[model samples]
Structure formats: C-alpha cells, structure tokens
Target: MDQPFRHIIALAALALPAFATNARAEEAALIDGGKLLLTNGVTTIEGASGGGLASWATIAGRGTDRGIGLSTHVTLIELPDYGWQSHGVALGLANRLELSYARQNFDTRDVGTALGLGKGYRLNQDVFGAKLRIAGDVVYGEPLLPQISVGVEYKRNRDAPVALTVGANAAKGADFTLSATKLFLSHSVLVNATARLTKANQAGLLGFGSNGNDNHSLQFEGSIAYQLSRRAVIGAEYRSKPDNLAIAKEDDWLDLFAAYALTRNLTLTAAYVDLGSIATFDKQRGGLLSAQLAF
Candidate 1:
C-alpha cells in the first residue's frame, strides 16, 4: 500500500466501528442475509456513492433493510504521464443521506519538471461532500419512478499559487449535482443520469478556474450497469467537464468498470479510465483499482 492510502486505511479502520454502530442489532447475527447484495454501490473517486468516475443515484448505504452503511476506499490511477491517488470514507445514514470526505493527490510526473516545479510535483486537494436521497429507490421504486438525489461537494486545493502562476483564476470551488437512477430488475440492467454545476478545472484537482473564464457550467454524467449475478456488476460511465482553465483545456472523462462484493462488508472495483488531456499531457489513459469496506 502507498503511504497516503495506508494512512487513510488506518483512519478508516478506527472509524469503522462508529459507522457500524447503528447496525449492532444486525451485526450480532453475523450473517446479514436480509440486505440484498450489491445494493450499496461502489465508492467513487470523489468519495461519493457512485460509479468509477460519476456519481450514481443510489445512496451509499445498503438500503432500508440495513441501518447505516459506512465505506472506506482507496483509488489509484496511473496515466501515461500522470499519476493520481485518492482515499476517503463515506457514511450512509439509513440509506437516506450520505457524507463523504476525500483527499486527492495528483502527481505531475514529467509535467512538473517541464514547469520547473520538480520531477514529480504533487497537487493535493481535500473534498467534502453531502448527499440526500430525496425521492424514490434505485431498486424498489414503484410505478417506474427513478431514485433521485441532490448533492454538493466542496473542494479545497492546497497549491493555489502554483495554479495561479499557471493562469488559473481561483483555487476553491463547490459543485452541485442532481442524480436519478433506475433499476430494471427483470432485465438485469441499471441506468443513471446526473447533472452538475461547477467552475472547477479537472474536478478541482487542477484548481477552481482560470483567468480567461470562470463561469460555472452545467455538466452531464451518465451510467449504465449490467448485473451478472447477485454480487457482481459491470458498468460504463461518462462524465462531462468544463474547460475553465486557460492553461490547459479540460476534457470529459469516461470509464468501464466492474464492482464485486467479496462479502457483505467488502467490495472490490477495477476500471479503465480515459481523461483526454491535462495541462499539456494528452491521451491520459490508465487503469483504476478501488477497495471498499462497508457495514
């Protein structure tokens, strides 16, 4: 394990009991059979309950069947010329709301040397998020209404001077999102749509905005998943982004991913990611792996 990821795992291990406290009534049973498998989706890179690169309509918790679901995840992505890692914890309260916090580290790799920053300069960001499942259910909705959620993420970038030196406008920003998810159980397929408003560049990892333009833009994220079994899923996702920074035009992100429940409390995820370009690096294609523990 990497240093940052290991540190986060330690914290999560200590916090796990707190997140699972509400479920003591069921924990004693040791066999959580009532809660259907794979209902609590995998943790997104931003620490929200979602797909690999996009937020899903489903809440973080298991469902009404389970009390509280707390999850911790570590994601690492290796691009052709860039490296990124993020770790976070998400807590779901009664499957109705979610709270998440994440720390992201972006290794500039060769870009750092080109910019005279260092051989492998890193940009660190802290993100805090909250989400509310306002209506419907992803799996058990009646009359075909989709599950809906509203969310917000506040991002704080640590290296503002570097971003501004490179022609960025601001360093901190928040994104507001709305998501709707539906499950066609009979067909074994799931679909979701999400809308986000933001002015952040590179999802706030490259700062908030650039001097040329700083207006908040509406972005879209869509996902489709096919269930292969009770504990496994395959999905594809696309997330649009704003080209707010003049230093480097931003591009949309896409990924194909899989999530599997190894146990009621453990889930694993793997993905192939494509982030067109950043700063000056092009064809940023890579893979992502994440492990989640929830109860």
Candidate 2:
C-alpha cells in the first residue's frame, strides 16, 4: 500500500479504539451538542472546517457547548489527465477557534511528459490555516441568524522552479476568507457564502500571482447542503479561482458531494467534481473520495 494510505490506516486503528472506549464509558452522559451530527462539517481543501471545496463558518468538532475536537481527513481525486491527493489534520477548540495543516500533491501524470518533464511529475504544497468563529449560530433556528467566521491560509509550494517556469510570481502566498453559514433545521437545509482575498493561483498549486499582477483579488466560494437524514447530507459547492498566470489559465471548481456519518466520530464523503480547465487541460472532471475521523 502507499505510504500515506498506510499512515491513515494506522492512525485510525489507534484512535478508533480510544474513541469507542470513551463513548462506551460515557454513553449515558450526553454532551449537549450545539450542532447536529455531521453538521460541524467536513474538511475543506485548505484543511479548514467546511465543505469539500470551500470553508464554512463552523468549527471542526462535535463538541459544541464546550471541549476540544480533532479531525483528520484524506482526500484523493483522479482527474481526466491529472490527479491530486491531499491529507490534513484539524483541531477545534471550544467550537470557537480552529487550526489546521494540510499537504497536497498534484500529479502531472502524462502531462508531465508532454511538458518535457517526463512522466509522473508531481508538485507539492503545504497549507496552514487558522479560523475564528466570531458570531451567530448555525443551529439557532429560532432567530435564523447565520454563523460568521474569518480565516487565513498560508500556502507554500515546494515546486518553486516549476512554478516560476509557468509564469507564477511567487511560491508562497496567503488567502483570507470571510464566511457566513446558516442552517435551517426545520427545512433541513444549510447555505453558506464566502468572500476570499487571494493571490494564489490554482489553490496555490500553481503558486501565487504572476509578474504583471502580483496583488490579491477577491473571489467567491459557496456551498448548499441538504440533510437527508440524521446521518446523511448532500451538498454542492462552487469555488472561483484566480486567473493570475498567463501560461495556463485557471478556472472555477464545482462539486456535488454526499456525506454519511457511520458514527458520531466517523464520516465518509464522496463527490463528483468538475474542476473545469486546469493548466490548459479542458474538462478536468473527476471523482473525489474522502474519509474523515473526528472526535
């Protein structure tokens, strides 16, 4: 098995028993949860607490009233001519603050050979993020106010030479996001809107900006989810990308995803993603699979 997959399996094996023991010992004592099961959210691309493609205004744990929660996820995407794999860990404190770290590997695949870099070329990136939920409540259905949060992602690309060759101005950049998320329990629906300021191209895989325009631009990302059952959620997400480099124009990303909670601490998510064009490769649509372990 691949090293990353092995690591995930090992970690899950070790943690699952602890979680099961704790739950068994405390089953009768219910922790007054502020949000619904699987509602705290799946991990975002940048490792924040949110949907698959974009970050939401929620923290990363089921412990809503108080306590700490930790979540880790492994995501894999197989595009038409490329591939992407990401894994990350996030920790949420008191359902008010969140911190995360993620590693991304973009596989050039055959495209690498076409670009004269041989086959199987990969670009690596690391992302560190922090978020603070400032106001409102997602489950506060009585007043129907949206949850609001602010976040920042500091991204660094390891393929600096390749990024520069592709017209990227820098290998490092930061993105700031302000998100508003609202959930209607009566209607079993949730909606989120986010505005982001970023200079990173292709979510930092292609690096930050270009020579001509080295400043950040405002972008939008959103998600809408419907709760089908106590443990199932179906959602769709859209994320607009920055067009910074001239070598290969970036495009918007979209995904239709479903998440099912096997238990309070385990959730699985799958999605059909249409990433539009990436690096001049059209129709970079693919499937995504993600497993999240949370406590």
Candidate 3:
C-alpha cells in the first residue's frame, strides 16, 4: 500500500473510538433518569421516583429489582363541621410487599354537641395496611398502561364510650380493597379504579344504629390524571362511602390536585377536596398538602 494511504487509514481508525464514545454519551444524556411521577385515577404512586400523597393507584415495585425502600406520608382532611388529621409512614419492601401504619384524629367542631357527645370529642384510631403487586410495570412497558395491586387494611378504633353511644358498632374491623391502574401513553393520562367491602358499624365511628341501620356495604373509588410535564401532573379522584347511620347521610367527594417533583428523592403535592354534604351539614371543602421522600 502507498505510504500516504496507510497514514490516512491509521488516522481514520484512531478517530473511530472517539466518535463512538461521543455518540454513546449523547444517547445517555437524552434519557430522563429522574423518577417519574405516575398516577392512576385518584391514587398516585411513585414511578421511577419514590412516593408522594396524591391518593389513587401507583406503579408497583420499589427500586429497579435489587432491593427495597420506604415511603412516608402525613395527611390532613378537613370537613365542614369536623376536621380530621392522620400521620403515618409505610415501608415498601422489594416493591412486592408494603406495610403501613397510620393514626387518625377526628375532631368534632360543633356536631358533637348536637349528637350529645359534648363540645369536642377526639376519636383516634390506628390503621395497619399491607399491599402486594401481582402484575404490570410502570417504567419499561407502555407509558399508558399500569400495574395491578391487591391490598387490605386492618383498623382499630379507639373511641370507647363515646363511640359506643354514638357509633355503637365502632369496633376493630378489616377492610379489603382491589385496585386496577392504567397509564395512557398517547394522552399522558393515568386511570385507576378500586372496590372495597366494609362493614357499616365498624367503618362509621359516630354510631351505626342511629336511625335503625346495621350492615355493611360496598364502596367505589376512582381517579384520573394527566401528565403536564416531566415534573408536574394534574388529576382528580372520587370516593363513595356508606351511610350506615341515619343521623347523617354519607356522600362522596371530588378532588383536584397538582404535584411537583422537587428532586430525585422528594416531591410535593397540593390538592383541593370537596365533600358534598351529610344530611343538613354544610358542604365540606378544604386543601391538602403532602410531601414524600424515597431512597
């Protein structure tokens, strides 16, 4: 071969590795490696990211497939004449099994007096819950499809005598919920639906036999969300509760929320909830704010 031709070939070969390395770096830079905020119906679960309180179904599994992590939430709910607050944390082990513990404080603003329970009677309860994901993926599969999960919660009511008089059936009980979620890649939407079977007396802490009712009923919950961007999402959800007590009529609520991803390990969510009404009680509407962290 000619001397000049040999030199040209060697030079081209020397530049090949550099060109390949640059190409690989560019491809890696295009991939969004941060956690993705995913939602289904009223439930919001961590995607590639971790956890935040949005209510609804979320993508299952914790990390990539090597280990597990923990998700914690502090939630507050405000009603027209009453206000309730809950504080709890959950452990997501291997993204397969989840265990959670929560404490709820129910305060009677003025409704307590009408029920003859006094000025302010606070009812606190401890709730323990577990969830398992049986199918699907949120990271690698279709952007519009989601995973499925089955879970149950055991609640222990601590409202003693007051609960006996008003919510005579306010005892410990187990509630089961079946959840299904789907992510719409084309529209950037997430949808979720859930059905729960629960008892009337044990679920209603005020009293079951108020007007002569004592039984259980089925409840339905759903939510839909749209991804505004990689870091923001907007969604809404509805929950139907049973009215086992005659003194009050149970009603469902609608929620609108917007969430922001702060970092790979943290997220912030804000929501507005509207609880129609219970009997003559005024409609309850309030705001909810939550922060979540995962590792």
Clashes within 3 Å, all models in order = 1, 0, 19
In candidate 2 the C-alpha lDDT for residue 55 amounts to 89
Q: What TM-score would candidate 3 get against the native?
A: 0.74
- TM-score per model over all chains: 0.87, 0.88, 0.74
Candidate 1, poorest ten consecutive residues by summed lDDT: 2-11
Model 2 over residues 1-295: C-alpha lDDT tens digits?
5332343344344434544655555543333344579879898877888999998998887765345578899999989899999999997655666778999999999999997767999999999877777788878744567989887788889999988888999988888889999888889999999999999988999889999999999999999999999999999999998898887878899999999999888899999999988888899999999889887
Task: For candidate 1, write residues 1-295 as lDDT tens digits.
Answer: 4333343344345435544664674654332333467766788888898888999876675545346666788999989988999999987765666779999999988889997889999999998887777788888859489899888787888999887887778778778889998888898898999999988888887787677778888999999999999889999999999987666867899999999999887889999999998887789999999998876
Q: How much lDDT does candidate 3 score?
A: 0.56
The worst-scoring run of ten residues by lDDT in candidate 3 lies at 40-49
Error of 3 at 278 (Å): 4.8
Local distance difference test, candidate 2 = 0.84
Q: Which candidate should be chosen as best, given lDDT against the real structure?
A: 2
In candidate 3, which residue ranges exceed 4 Å CA deviation? 1-35, 38-62, 142-145, 200-204, 207-215, 278-280
Q: Which stretches of candidate 2 lie over 4 Å from their true place?
A: 1-35
Off by over 4 Å in 1: 1-34, 63-66
Better of 2 and 3 by lDDT: 2
lDDT per model, in order?
A: 0.81, 0.84, 0.56
Model 1 root mean square deviation, Cα atoms: 6.5
Which scores better on TM-score, 1 or 2?
A: 2
Residue-level lDDT tens digits of model 3 in 1-295: 5332343344335434543554455543321223344331111321112222222334222233233445555556666687767666665444444556677777776877876667676767776666655567544476645666666556667776765655446456555666767766667776777776666342434433333544556788787778888678888877777766554566676788877767655667778887666434767777767666544
